[model samples]
Target: MVRGEDRHPSLSLHLRARQTAEYRASTAEAERQLRDNDPDARPHRLQHCRGLRESGCNRVLGIINLENFERENAYGESELRLLTTIAASLGTALENARLFDETQHLLKETEQRNAELAIINSVQAALAAELNIQGIYDAVGDKIREIFKNRDMGIRVYDPKTDLIHYAYTYENGKRLSLESEPLGNAGFAAHVLRTRETLVINENMTQAMTKYGSYALPGTQVEKSSVLVPMVAGEQARGIISLSDMEREHAFGDSDVRLLQTLANSMSVALENARLFDETQRLLKETEQRNAELAIINSVQAALAAELNIQGIYDAVGDKIREIFKNRDIGIRVCDPKTGLIHYPYTYENGKRLSLESQPLGQTGFTAHVLRTREALVINENMEQEVAKLGATLVPGSQMERSLIYVPLVAGDQARGLIGLMDMEREHAFSDSDVRLLQTLANSMSVAL
Candidate 1:
């Protein structure tokens, strides 16, 4: 019961310690006096003339001295009885105080745990924004480590072809594995669990008589004492297996532990599947965007081949094409006429970040002009040295950040309309292939706008 005696915060213990110290000192003084001339009534020698006073206060505990303790000048029966009564009354109060302390401690622990869980939830949500395979795996495994107190956990991605299990990521050894082989192969409990796609529990005694899973487990990877293994399944397909190794405790895991692992695995499975699909979607979107961008460039070139009937028409036609394909609003057609080296023909600005006809020029002044001269499309960081300041021409006072931008040039035989620029406002998010193709095609269309 005194497992945490050193940590006890009882006011009673302090009082008792103080009282015992005082009593020991007094007894020593009494014994020293007894050694002197008066041994029989030594107590009388020291206290014969002392005045005693009693204070009015609610008493709790009572202490009883033995009958023969008078040799030590101890209390009489009445006083002993009173001490007993005090102790009796204080018993219930002490018990209640202990209970209240325990409850308060438990409540504090629960609140701290709740705060930790909230942080984990936020991390998981942030992970959700990522749609990459490795990113998803890292996120899931990281989350598993965190939920399980960031201690011991293992993962083996399913190999449908080889039909074997191997470690995907292990929160073990800081890369200094206790088990052999960096990636655990088909052998011990891991293989057994993964091969069967079944749940395994090694509550206590990790690497023991695991006969049934002998063929399934990692060689010598034994359960040791306590561990839990669960198969990670996604879309009815086994994607991987999660293994948790227990550290120093009886009944290392319980039903709640099992349920929690299963729940996290399920979420991880779904998240992995979603990430893969999103990656594929991104690929598809890229291809489509590339094709559209090419067609737009072609259209711009062809339009330039014709006379500039209505520069606004060319600008609108191409700009609308870009908005439809790339989902961008900052689009404009710039022309390079031997008559006028630079000209900006516009349709409409969007996303509330418009292009200033006065300051921010379209062609080479932006990415489009550079592309026109080199006949190469240009993509640049939206927050470069010069652009950082020029951005103010379009953005609000303290907000100058966009994702990325691209520019394509229109060439008509020997002549070319300066260039066309398109932009979006989510950095590190590059323009899609379809967007490039569409812009190129629109560049082809800008000659007439010139």
Candidate 2:
């Protein structure tokens, strides 16, 4: 009501009562709706009506209800001035409270931010202390778990040569876990990450997440509620992936969590790259050493072959060097007589002992005969027992028979000259491709010497 109005005091009181009833009804309905929508919603705070204004300003901070002041008559000047003063005092207090609450919130936020910054710095420091992939992975897992309280994480290192994803490191339930490598085509979470080279954030059902990734969740004892898969990329190449998972909390990861993990992944990528380079360098060094050793063996064999020695002397010299080079003691050099059509074992060294096998017909009964007939190198292991039996071949005639054998045809001219056989009765697949090649080279040199 306007001041100094020619209106009845009864009318003014009736109008105020009606307005209060409407406000109560509206407030009750709003609270009911809110409670229905959210079971855990808080009760609505009481709000006062806006009535006071100074200097044409209408910014309402808060209000104080005066409904209990049951005045039947129109308010006089003294009561009006008192109500205005109360309104101004209430507005000032409300403004101060709002400012205080904001300041407290900002302080708490600053503390949280500082704590996160400290964690990042600590992780960076830990990462810096490591120069290898495994060490970096361990540092990341420990630091992240210490700060974020997560215990499940996995690091996969990609080997391009083998095209395999190797689980380099893993932590689960506060314990370090070791894992085996699998082919990249395996249908699992890590495999999918490696194939796609994309970061996957899963906060919902794991089955659905796996389906989205076009695979099933890798078999594990622990169930995961939320997870993140970040691909570790160095330059244009993807080195591996870091999988962060939570077994307990759904929606455990946030935008900030993803960013932190990505940062860790980037740092780990560089470290893995460094480790790969180091490994490659070591491998090259080893290859060079092996090459030098083989070259020296070849030179020694040539020098011995060129000496003015008899057939027995040549066989002894070659047998000694072959044993030294191959590090195998079971060796036999059989020379074939083109006229007699039989193989003659002039040199038979078995575990540093000389055995006498004067001569035998070149029939389909042994590996030497098979090589003499076919003129092809044959490398046989335990798996090739059926093939060896079909060939009806037995070179060494004892308990230490055909565990593994390599028979190379020695050819000097247009026809097969003889056969050189090496056997390993202790191990299967002990000889690699290089071993076969080097032995063939020795067989050729021996053929020429004969």
Candidate 3:
């Protein structure tokens, strides 16, 4: 221990004997207490020794027992730097082992989460690419199955017009299929979400609940236990539900599952909207193509017919075209001799170019005169009461028809030439904006052809 002594003087036989004795004593005491199940959480304490020496003929370091478990051990002024260095190395190694174990667990958890998120992203991508509404539903169902690694899944859609939630899709036994729409009430889970715009979950005995929304009470399936019902809310509207069910697992639907489902549901809302818009665009495109084909035919017919043709022939050709365009059950065209003040001609058809009733006189009626004066299309929607007031009966003199009428006057440069008319004989279907625009398209083109 003197200054300038050999750095690691070899331990003599006598010094080795003393150091070995101390090590055995500490080791025996530590083992005895641990065997007795002693809760001695403290680290082992080493005893101090003197008269120590390095073993001979060996590259060995000095061994000295220091006092004080903490205060004297830390390297500072008046410190044995080598002993302090040894303690520091051993302390760091132990801490490093604990830190490494902790990091391993964290990495494992993160990897699992990443894998699940990857599955979710793939599902969202598939849903977004769907151009048909049904396709999106199917993709969502399949994604749910894949994420649960081919487990079961289901979905519901809420329709505001019908005020009902309908089962739209389900995944069972690793396969997904469209769930035929089954009406569900506006109360319970549906109402809770609708009122609060919040999510709904029922994680109890799903099979025991005897309702349409209940799990596996599906009229075709056996009882299933725990289930989760998630609301697919979008655009201030409750679009659908994603219900999960299993025959086992009481803790299947927990807060964690609900939160994950919510995040997925938000993505689902976006996917649903994208799919709906893509579908609508495709439908509009197809209709546009059809309209263009019809216009091609009309242009050909227009070129063949002349400007000097009598009003009656123009009425016949235009009526035919209007029937093609509107596809109404009944359509009529009438011409009035303005100078003669008498009925000139009338042409009518019922459904797809069928030879309707015989040609009738315009009868110089005031209804014709009124429309001729206005030169504006008048549409009356389901006017049985109005007809009773005008025609003095529950119906008109027509063969057999109900519903409504659209009266349009042919006005070319302030000259009221004639009129084109229609009556949806049976279907009480209200006309939409597109329907009105289509009718106007036919009316405008008919005026030019006439």
Please estimate how well model 3 matches the true structure, expressed as its whole-model Cα lDDT. Answer: 0.57
Tens-digit per-residue lDDT, 284-391, candidate 1:
887676666656655664574475647555556556666665555566555555555545445445454544453233334444444656777766654544664453
lDDT for each residue of candidate 3 in 1-450, tens digit (9 for 90 to 100):
121233232211111222243433332453343336534433322333222222232222223444333332333344445544554454455445656999997885675565456545655676556536666676667766666556577777777777766666766554555445555554455556655667656566554453644323555554556666667776777677776766555656677667666767776776676666677787798579557745844674475475555655556666665666665547777666666665444676644344434434444334566677777666667664575357333322445554666667767787677776676766655455455556656555566655
Listed in order, each prediction's TM-score against the native is 0.37, 0.46, 0.42
Find the number of clashing residue pairs for candidate 2: 1
Ranking by lDDT: 2, 3, 1
Every candidate's CA RMSD = 16.3, 13.5, 16.9
The lDDT for every candidate, in the order shown, is 0.55, 0.66, 0.57
TM-score of 3: 0.42
Off by over 4 Å in 2: 1-230, 234-237, 240-275, 372-376, 383-387, 395-400, 411-416, 426-434, 437-450
On TM-score, the leading prediction is 2
lDDT against true structure, model 1: 0.55
Per-residue lDDT tens digits of candidate 2, residues 176-199? Answer: 777677677766676666667788
**Displacement of the residue 156 alpha carbon in candidate 2, Å:** 8.7
Q: Which 10 successive residues of model 3 have the least lDDT summed? A: 9-18
Candidate 1, which ten residues in sequence have the lowest lDDT sum?
Answer: 45-54
